[model samples]
Target: MSRTSTESVTPTPAVARRHRLPGKALLGLFLAGFVSILTECLPAGLLPEMSRTLDTSVSLTGQTVTLYALATALGAIPLARATNKMPRKHVLQLALGVVAVTNTLTALSDDYLLTLVIRFVAGLGTGLIWPLLGGYAARLAPAGRQGRAIAIALAGTPIGLALGIPVGTWLSGLGGWQLAFHASAVATIATMAWAMATLPNLPGRPAEARFTISQALVIPGLRTILFALAAYMVAHNILYTYITDFLSHAGMAGQTGWVLFAFGVTSVLSVLVVGTHIDRHLRKLAVGSTAVFAASVLVLALFTNAPVLVYVAVAAWGFAFGSSPSLFIGAAINATGDAADVAQSVTITVFSASIAVGGLTGGLLISGLGTASITWAALALLIAAAATVIGGRKHAFPRNS
Candidate 1:
């Protein structure tokens, strides 16, 4: 594993001795996360409009998102490896640049194939960004606030997941699909500039200090973290991927945006709570999040006809899920120590793969079984994830750090 630089150069010993959060730098990372998700999910929200503009079927237009996820999944580790020795800030800059350029091209692309290619490149850029964000935030933080810093940096995820699509959809309605994408491009560009101005420059590690990806995988608890991550993500995506359909099935299709907004709001609150206590209660929080998630899915499975319960379940689900990146990435860094970067990369790869798994599995279940079946499947996976977390208590999610 390699050490990742956050915004700037490594802090001096005197700076490292302080006990304060670098708010601007962490928020820069937050914006990076925001743009990453906003870019990936914007297309899904505007699929019908984008399909019409590109003169393709809705299914084909949807492939833009599919290809993006695949690219991120396939490219994460390799990209992490390729850029391991580069200055952390430069790597971040390069990634932001790629995303900015690709997003602009995606907005301008009239051909579906070209849009797919542009999105794939955008995915690769995100692949590089996701793997380093937590570790980067950790390095940027002073002692005792690493978890808080991670929470702040990763908060962009749930916010983007919550607002990005709805906003993009709104933008598409007002202007067109291209306007939504152009907004993404502009956001990425602005975030890149903020990162450059706020983040310090840290030199890359020497080759001798880096460990192989194989070595990272063999670390004591890395595999367990990755497994739990995969399972949790799969469980989340199953219901999430077809949320609109599930709402439609529940006769609340018109409330899709509001439901997601509720989910997002709770998720942000979850981040705040998790950030405040994560360093002291990592294991307890991780286990509780999984359990709550499972419980929420159970409610969804049994009470689809109850609109009030549905909203409550979705809100609970979001709160349970909101701090996951902070929890999992924080755990991985704790487990692998110096190999945190590699482990983060591996964790991200699994996370992306799980998205594909969840989507495919959800589609299969919905087509053959019904939207109701997806909730049960999500419950089963959540149970597995919870089991792994409890069972790996000694190393993976140790009670004491």
Candidate 2:
């Protein structure tokens, strides 16, 4: 499990030069990343309204988030395998195209079941997008700048969550949930066009070794990081999936958009800070951020009445969670070397699965234990995630090459 045991795989000079298109390509990837997350999380902010419109319980509307995550979890590996031979740029375009079309259909659909099915389709595209984009970012980066490059690309998640989710929520308030989806469709289409114009043609390399789930499971570093990631994400989604509801319950209903906006703003700031240091301090960054995130959730759980405290907690949570994917993905790539794609795919699967479980469990908890219980539930999971990192400190993060 030591870093020394895993050999670092270097890219050929010719391949590196071919894939390197840092400026515009990185920006395009960032927007694509933002759109991907915005599409997945759009339902979170509009759950109550969507439930009323579809004549269903809020808990049932929440299942749409679960469904999308489950679909992405199930499809990530198979879809990655299927497209392993295609050019990376084409795969990205195709995935974004699916996002655009499915979201458009989502906006147009009036039936709950039809919307769920279309979201599931969008999930399939999202499944392909995450790992491919991560790998693509890694490929495009110039040597030591891989961590920052991936951070820039993956910054979309928080940016989307920070800006897109709140904006979507506000738009839904003005024009209904359908308007939110329509906007997502428009944004995704624009991202696709930018990607097409900017991204270099990145053909896949043939596998150097037979990469499989069983192999990934046996790698000690990979196993520990994935487990830690699952726990962290489960904690994150539990609170995230129901934040609007929690806000409403706290009598802060009118402030949901503004609160989420504040959260996103700090998130972007945190990613920028973490991006610079992740290559040198992967394990410390992982452990420290999760600890901050967990502490923030505890504050929310315990100090619900103080508005100032609540906003502080939200900003802390945003800053901590915002920097996580890049930290985790960078750790995974360091762990798996030549099998980075397999590692990335497995990480995405674990991530999506955790989101599915967390959202579903949060729904059940909300129905039975009430909305406030979710933060406590999330804090417990985050504690476990932190322990995983501390316990596997030596093995989970290898030395930067």
Candidate 3:
């Protein structure tokens, strides 16, 4: 009898073994993600209080938020590489400790400089945990379960966006920005404690497979994937940063908060949808959804002023925003053969840079040009990203590479 290719290839004993992550480890991973992101998004809701406490303009305080994004982007590459030799659990635990302490410093500061300094340190620590979790998630998940595992971990994005800002604002109203950081520190510490007890070491590669940050960046598929994902990210975040302001400008001033609430819920649902579906058709999902995402951005930009149209635009953006993160995660894992963490670190480094440039430029663009101009800029980014997706279909990424 002739053997078919599918039947000829035999599975090794290691490949055939049943695998599952322990329940407690999964919870610890998700909690680590939740707190790490809260440290980023919480300050968004507390920006007004940050201004008063630091004796700066609300706009200047907004730069602190941008600073975290900037630092995190630049920091991810070197920090991720440096920690390659360390235990995954130790690196993350150390990073969280820094967050806890730095967050505490921000709470105690009466001086503006002290607050900024503490935030800067906290931002670097914040950078380390995200990619570590990516690596950790890849390691912890069973062979066929990486997507859902990552989704469960990545939910922190929307949850942080949904809970962090609103809760921080609510907390600030009751106590102050200082209290908000105190709460942040408490959360960070608790996550670290849980991680120390729960997360596996997720062993490092055989020496032959190990690569440096420079080597990782040189791979063609990895580079292209990062560029495309970054372009998509830059556009999405630029639109996201000014959404609340856009809602007000669109003449829905009183109902903007409700619009934001709608976005959060829709965004969470979108994340779940993508997390569930991406595995079966990653290429189509990345391309089609991104096209839809781009189209919605265009629609939002041109029709923002119609009150009824504004809600629809917000939900569209929310859904896209939710789906994009997981899509990018799936893309990164596909691009790098076995080093999803390395791929994740590279992806986020690009993501961070995209965010930094988008945030700073969008702020300036809004100030000098207008909100309409900001959307035009984002439209250009999306157009470029759409082109990349077209090219990617011809030269698929290294799925395990």
Which candidate wins on TM-score? 1
Q: Best candidate, lDDT-wise?
A: 1
Off by over 4 Å in 1: 1-17
Task: Quote the positional error of residue 195 for candidate 1 in Å.
Answer: 0.7
List model 1 lDDT by residue over 1-401, tens digit each: 12223557777878765757988999999999989988888987898999988999987887787788889999999999899889889999999899999988998989988888888999999999998788888889877778889889988887887776688889999999889888888989999999999998777767788888899999888899888988999999889878989999999999999999999999999999998988778888899999999999999999999999999999999999999988888899889988888888888898888877887889899999988999999999999999999888888998674
Q: What is the alpha-carbon lDDT of model 1 when measured against the actual structure?
A: 0.88
Rate residue 98 of model 1 by lDDT: 95
Error of 1 at 120 (Å): 0.7
* Model 3 lDDT tens row, 246-359: 766777767856877878888788767876655565666667666777787788788876777767777777776776666677667766666666778877778777777877
Q: Sorted by lDDT, highest first, which candidate order results?
A: 1, 2, 3
Better of 1 and 2 by lDDT: 1
Q: Could you tell me how far off, in angstroms, the CA of residue 185 lies in candidate 2 after the best superposition? A: 1.2
Clash count, predicted structure 3: 3
Over the stretch 311-350, how does candidate 2's per-residue lDDT look in tens digits?
9999999999897888888888877887788889999999
C-alpha RMSD for every candidate = 4.5, 4.4, 4.3
10 residues in a row with least lDDT, candidate 2:
1-10
